[model samples]
Target: MPTIVVDVMPKAELLDPQGKAVAGALTRLGHEGFAAVRIGKRFELTVDAADEATLATVRQIAAEILSNSVIEDVVGIEVVE
Candidate 1:
């Protein structure tokens, strides 16, 4: 089986209030040295094939459904055997 991994993250120019809140909580909990935090999404899909055609389709799906291109980006894609 092949597993497709996709990571979606907010664009640098976009505001991530959730991320900021998490960062603030971390700081309140005494965690330090981190400059900032940005929340994102990851999807792990097990598929029959990890070929280029499948990847292309997945990319299109990501672009269309998984991310808001105006404020987010599909940051990573990988196929794991």
Candidate 2:
């Protein structure tokens, strides 16, 4: 079996309150290495096979189901063993 990983991120123009909160916490904890942080989502889907047809279907699922088109973008989709 193979696992498909889908990465989704909020649109660049939108504000990510969760990310901001994390960044603030990092700063307060003396972690100055990170200038900013943007939170995103990752979905792992297990499949029997990693074929072209399956990949296409996964892409469609990533775009239409896993993420909101208005606020989030499907950044990446990859197959992992």
Candidate 3:
């Protein structure tokens, strides 16, 4: 089986409260080397094959179903071993 990985992230302009909270926690825990943190989503899809057609469909699915176009962007789509 092959796996398709989809990475989705909120638009840079939008504020991510969850990410903010995590960043705050990191700072409190003495991790000051990091300036900020932004959380995103990763979707792993298992398939029989990783052909071009399947990849196209996965791209569509990532844009339409896996993420919110209004606020998030499909950052990446790739086949994994």
Q: lDDT per residue, candidate 2, 1-81, as tens digits? A: 799999999999999999999999999999898987999999999998999999999999999999999999999999998
| Deviation of model 2 at 36, angstroms | 0.8
* Model 2 poorest 10 in a row by lDDT: 28-37
Error of 1 at 40 (Å): 0.2
Rank candidates, TM-score, best first: 3, 2, 1
> lDDT of all predictions, in order shown?
0.93, 0.96, 0.95
Which runs of model 3 end up more than 4 angstroms from their true locations?
A: none
Itemize residue pairs with steric clashes in candidate 3: none
Candidate 3, residues 1-81, lDDT tens digits: the string is 999999999999999999999999999998888778899999999999999999999999998999999999999998999
Q: Write the per-residue lDDT of candidate 1 for residues 1-81, one digit (tens) a residue.
A: 899999999999988999999999999999999889999999998999998999999999889998989999999988878
Candidate 1 Cα errors over 4 Å, as ranges = none
| Per-candidate count of clashing residue pairs (backbone under 3 Å) | 0, 0, 0
Q: Model 2: C-alpha RMSD to truth?
A: 0.7
Question: TM-score for every candidate vs. truth?
Answer: 0.93, 0.96, 0.97
Candidate 1 vs candidate 3: the TM-score winner is: 3
